[model samples]
Target: MTKEMDVTEKIIELLHELEHCTDSEQKQKIEEMNEIVDGMDEEEFESFFTLKLFNKTDKMIEEEKISMESVFLLLKSVGQHKVLMHSQSYAFHSSSLNKRFEQMIIEEEKKKEERNEKLLIDLCECTVLLSNEISSELLSIIVTCLLKVALKKDENEETQKEVEIALLALSYIEICKSVKQEWYLNEIKEIIKYHQEHHNLTHLAYQSAWQFLMNRFHFNKSLDEVIENELHFSRDATKELEALIKCVDWKRGKGEEKRKKKNKEELFLFRWLQTLGIFFFHWRLRNEECVGLISSVVQVFRASKDDNREISDKCIFCMGCAAENRVVENEDLLKIGAVDLILEEMQGPTLDNYFLERHMKCLFEDFRRLKNAEDYKNEEVKRKATKRKVFDKMEEEGFEDCIIGLCHYICLGEFRYFSLFENYPEYFVYL
Candidate 1:
């Protein structure tokens, strides 16, 4: 009781001091108050927050007695405390405060006052910190405000920085149920489209935002639902993929040099392929639609061939996913010479990249299975016929000898087949 009383009394004194403190002193007082708050037990914290600190800070901000900086510091400190963050008092106060920040952001967008940038950033950070605690309604308001500032047609560096922060904040927050409105979905997608179309946005910031939108859209719902809910989602996804291909300089490093580190564009492209892989796996493109899309993916695979193994592998992985679509077949992919490209990569002299090899093999299997699906209408005979047809095709292409040689290499441990051991331990046991 004595300790709690001492802490509460000290916090009260600091709050009083804040009403009169200079700019420099404000940080010190807030930091001291945070330190005092940090020392309190849960019961003491609940008591202090409900009875004293919440009303005090709200009153101070209402009266304009404390600077925005002081409010941010206090809120930052409160957000850091687990008990305080989960409390009803904190949620109510944060929602109220966020509304003020949302309005200020709108006003500041028109004003473009450099001085207010830091405050805007702090407010966004607050949104990020308390994201899991706040209602989705409040979250959407702040997001709408941030997007308003971000989607401005002008190429202002300060605006870019603000949008970057907003993107980072979006990346941090989980998608809540309430924010699943169509406009919200479109707003998020617009960020991705904007980044693809505009050179003004920073690559790293917009990439994070793109990833956030893709992740939530793909993971949070069933594929059928995703396709049904969004307007022209399939067309938009295809366009986004094509736009990314154009954005990349596929000629970097002659397509043969091992990249010690991927640049921003490389990272972005890699992520693009990964998300699209997820997209393709769940959603099947129409037969008419498959041509252009598969052609684009095949182009990426061909361009990346012999250049970046990681990207080449992703390209193959994506194609493998695409191959699983009912409309996509050995013919569509082969018509684009995708099968031949995979065979070329597989037969490359430097086939030491395990993932690249594995992906190529998986794609071959996808092609084989898809082809067999077209050939064998009887379900009982399809499995047996598929194997015979695969061997027959291999023999016709003089790949039978190659398969024997690969088997020997696997038995001799000349290849990195740890994946095989983990996935099919019986094969290694037989070896």
Candidate 2:
């Protein structure tokens, strides 16, 4: 026989023996086979290992010839590329793999065994790779399993890894357009609270929580409302926000090296800021809390404007929303210097289109309110002065004429020129 045929026959023989072997013997034989496969070069590995092992996974599972543990090891060895390539055709083609994963989760719960927990964690990692293939029902099952692992009271390194992986999986599933039932909402909240309390898991928890909230917001607005309302008044949320604000190293030291070191924390802080902004829009904050939130957001907006566009954009949106909602009144906004900071951005050279549009909307609304007062530009000169400060800044920055020209165009019924300002009706009356 040819050497290739001989090798194939020997592999087949080993598989046959693996089926009849004891657990110990099967493990030894599987390890030896895995070693042999692992030693092959990339091309050879694809032909012999990937095609032979994973492609036949269903048949092996049906015949009870290979354990899930073995399959997981093989998947890890082959890496993500091959797995994702075959995922749709092999791993996700049938319901069997999902059922097996569910069964593993059930077994772990009943036994509370570390080995089973580890296995489930490994499977959870695999799910992250196969997220695009996960169905709604399967996604729910995986989420429940991961949450159970994450909520464990154990505080060991292994337990933390489990929590990290679980949160990672939830984050992935959250972005997959997964369906979340109402019953799962409370558990998700608890997960968020628990991870928020754990120092090491805070980022992961918040990321997962944000994803969950956003997914729910997309699917069912009321469910998101429930979670947001519950979280808005929670001590945990308040503490987390405070902690996030404190973590910011405000000193923009000399050199790119220092700035790079701070970028990670800054990114996390921005994400937290974005989440808070969304929550603020939904839940009414007390005056003090609202002011504090605005102050932090404005600080970020100022710091990020020149260096980070993403954060700068998010901060501006948050500020504009706060202004529009009157979360803090015009007087309060000026007290905290929010209006001044916003005017500075509006007059800056690098103005974002979205930011300018929203800022103008805020200015239009404030101006219209001032103009519509009973004392119309007479005794209300102070309010007019306060309002004109924004336009005054614009004029100083050479943007006043542009604003006036746009206003005149809109007044003359040239609607196409101001389509971007369509959302703000106040602009028509005031500007």
In TM-score terms, candidate 2 sits at 0.59
Candidate 2 — what's its lDDT?
0.57
Question: All predictions: root-mean-square deviation over Cα?
Answer: 12.9, 9.9
User: Which runs of model 2 end up more than 4 angstroms from their true locations?
Assistant: 1-117, 129-134, 175-182, 192-200, 217-229, 233-263, 280-288, 352-355, 358-399, 405-418, 422-431
How much is 148 displaced in model 2, in angstroms? 0.9
lDDT tens digits, residues 1-431, model 2?
Answer: 24656444555566667777776787787666665544443344344543344445657777877777766654444433333122233334244554565566556556754556567667765655443456564555566766676666466777665565555456445434656575367777776666556555646455655555655555465764455455542344445555655666655664464242234456566556556566555543335556766776776667667766666777767766666555565656767777667656666665645566666655654555555565344657667666676556555656555565456545555543366565444543453
- Residue-wise lDDT of candidate 1 within 1-431, one digit each (tens)? 25556776777878898888887899888888888866665555666655345556667889888987888877665654532223434543445555675566556555654546556657766655544554554565556655555565557887776666556556445534344545356666566566656766665465556545655655454434434343344454466567766777766656554444344455556656665666666665454555666677777777676566677787777777766565465555656766666655665667664754565455555544544444446653644554454445445556544444566455565556544423332222211
User: What is the alpha-carbon lDDT for the whole of candidate 1?
Assistant: 0.59
CA shift of 61, model 1, Å:
22
Candidate 2: deviation at residue 415, Å?
A: 13
Error of 2 at 267 (Å): 3.5
TM-score of each: 0.52, 0.59
